[model samples]
Target: MGNLVGSWRFKEPSTVEECDSTWGSDSESDEPVAEDDSGISDSVSPAESERAPGHSGDTSPQLSDSPESAPKMKRSFYAARDLYKYRHSYPNFKKSRQPNEYRNLRFYLNKIPLVPDGIYIEEILSKWRGDYDKLEHNHTYIQWLFPLREQGLNFYAHELTQDEIKEFQSTREAKRRFLAAYSLMLDFYGIKLLDKSGNVARASNWQERFQHLNESHHNYLRITRILKSLGELGYEAFKAPLVRLFLEESLCHNTLPNMQHSVLEYYVYTIRLPATRRRLLRYARKHYRPAHAFLWGPPLKRRGGGVGPEGGVGAGSSGIRAPAPTPEQQRRGEDSPSSPSASSRIIVSSHNAMMCQDLAGGGHKGYAGLGSSMVGLEGTILMAGAQRDRNEYNEIVPL
Candidate 1:
C-alpha cells in the first residue's frame, strides 16, 4: 500500500562468458549486444526484417523456458510407450480369468484341512492327459470319466479353454486306463483295492500286478478297491483302519456287552459277515426250549404212552394207571347223629343250588371245574365235610 510501484534495484552486470560459465551453460557466444541499450539494438538487417513477419520479437520471454521442461516431454513419451507395451502384451487378458482360477485352486488345495477337491481334479486331469484316446471304447471307463469332466468344467467355469477341456477329457481317460491297469496288476498279485464303498475286489495275482506300478502311479489299488467296495455298500471304508483299531481295543479290554453288539453290527454291515446266521440260531434255540419239553424231554411220558426218549412205547406194554375215588369217598359220608350229637345235611341240592353258569350264559350247567375230575373230587369232599359240621349246630350252613 505504501509503494505499489517500487524502485527497480539492479545488480552489477556480468560478462556473457561469466553468466554462461556460472550457470553451467555450454553455448559459445557468437554475437554480442551493447549492455547500455538494455540488450535491445536498433540495427536491423534484411534477413531479420524478413523473419519479423513470423517472429514476435519477444526473445526476452524465452529466458523462462529451460532444460527442465525437456524432462517433462521425455516422461510423456516413456509413459506412452509403457501404455502401448502393456496393451500389446495382454490383448485378451481381460477375457480369461485363468490367473484367478489357478490361484483359487492352489489356495484351496493348500489351505483345506482335509482332502482337497483339487487333488481329485489334478489326478483326473493328469490321467486324462496321459493317453485318453485309448479309453474311448471302454464303457466303464467312459461312464466314470464323463461325470468327472462335468465336475471340472463346472468348477473352473470360464477360466478353462476349449483346448484345456479336450485335454482334461483325455486326461480322465488316461486315469481310467491307469486305474484299470493298476487294478489288474494288483489282481495278478493277489492284492485287493479298498474304496469308499464297502466292497472288496481281490487281485488274485497281486505279485505280477505289482511289477506294472511305477513312481508316477497312485499305486493304491488294494486300498482304493477296498474303499470303493465299502463305499458302494454305504459304509465308511475310509475309516476302516480306525474301526479296526477300536475293535481291537474292545476285544483286548473286554468292554461292555453293548460294545460288542455295536462292533458286531458294524462288522456285519460293513464287512458283510455271517452275523445274521448266528443271531437267528440264538433266537431259535431260545424258543426251542419249551418245545423240547413236550416233544423230547421227560414231559413226553405224561402224555400217555407217547414216544419215549429212545422210541415209541410198545403197544402191548401197559403204562402207569391213575386211581379213581369210590362213591362213599366221593360223597364223604356225613357224621352219624347222637354219636357226637352230629347231623347229616346236604349243602347243595336241586333247590337253592348255585348252578354253574356258562361263560356264554346259555343256561345253568354242571361246573366246568379246573382240570380233570380227580382234582375236582378233592375240593368237593372238603366242602361236604364242612356242611355236615355246620348242620350239627356248630354254624350256619350254605352250599
Candidate 2:
C-alpha cells in the first residue's frame, strides 16, 4: 500500500514534455496528486502535509513506474469517433434482429465483390422478380441503386419492371427515392426524356401541379437534392429549375438552404471547367458558402471556383408516371435572361440545354460560352417538370 500513488487526475498530457510539466512539482511541494479531466483541479496544499508535527518533508511517496501504475494515454478523436458512434448502436444482429446497423470491419475488408453492376443488379432483380409487395426490407433495392449509379450507368432506370415501379409508387418515401433515381438518369443520360403521347398527360394547370407535388416539405428537399445531383453528374437537363431556386428565393420558401447549398457546393467543389464554374458562381451570393459548406473541402477562395462525376441520388422511373413539361412550359421556364438576376441563370440553362441537344444528337455546336462545364450535353431541355398525383410526387419527371 505504501508504494501506491496517493491520488490521480483526469488530465492527459498529449506529449512527453506536457506530461512532465503536468506532473512537475515546485521546489517545496511534497504531496502527490493529479487534476481531474472532469473539470476539477486538485494538488495537495503544503498545509496538508502527510507527516504529523516534526516529520521530515522529504518522506513523500513517489509515483511508481510499474505497467499498471503508469499514467495511461487517452483516446484520440480520430480513432475513437467512429467506434464511439458504433458502440452506441452496438449492432448485434442477434439482438437487433436486423443487418441495418451491422458494420463489420470484415465486410469492408472483403469488399463489395467486383462484378458488372448491371449484371449484378439484374440477377438480384430476377429472384426478386419485380414483386416488392411482400418484401419487408428495401435494403436489396437500395444496394442495387447506389453502386450501379456510382459507376456512371444512368440508363439503369429503363431496366425496372412495371411491377417494380409500382412498389416505389406505393408510398411517399418510396416515391422520393424513385425521384432520386430518375434524377440519376437525367444526370447521366438526359436524352430519353420524352414520348409523343407524353405531352398531353399533364393537361392540368402546370404551375398548380408543381405546387401540389411540393406541398410536403420532404418532397421539396428531394426535388432540390435531385437537381444538385444533376449538376454533380454533369447533366444539364434540369438546370432551369435549378437556376430558378436561386433566382427567386420564393422557390425555396419555407425550406432551409439545403438544396441551395447542395447546388452551390457542386458548382464550387465539383464543376471542373472554369467558364462553367464561373457561370454558376455568378449566381452565388458573396456569403453563400457560410450557410452550409459541403463536406468535400473548405469554402473555395476567390481566384475563382467550381465541382461532380461519381456518387448520386438513385434508380430512374419508367413509364408509370406523368410526362415531361411541354415545349411551351419549357420555353417559359427557359426564358432568355432578361433581368440582371436572370442573365447568369440564362447562361446555366442555355448551357445545360446545349449539352442535352448534343448528347442526344440534337445537331448543333456546343453552347458558345459553355466551355467544359457544358461539355457533350445535347438534349438541352429533356426534363421540363416532374409530376405526382395528390402530392405523393412521382419520381419519373419529364426529361
Best by TM-score: 2
Residue 267 in model 2: lDDT: 21
lDDT of 2 by residue, 1-399 (tens): 433434432232233223221113311132323322111012211111111111111111122323222211111222122111111111111121123222111112222321323233323333443232322233233323322111122322222222222233344543343334443332221112233211112222334433433232333323333433333222333444344343333222423232343333222322222333333443343223221211221121221222111121110110011123467745754674432232232223222233343454533443332332232222123323111111211222111
Q: Name the regions of candidate 1 deviating beyond 4 angstroms.
A: 1-116, 121-228, 231-246, 254-262, 273-399
Candidates' lDDT values, in order?
Answer: 0.26, 0.27
lDDT of 2 at 80: 23
Model 1 lDDT vs. the true structure? 0.26
Q: Candidate 1, residues 174-219: lDDT per residue as tens digits?
A: 3343344434333433445465232334345433333332111222
TM-score of each: 0.15, 0.22
Worst 10 residues of 1 by lDDT: 48-57
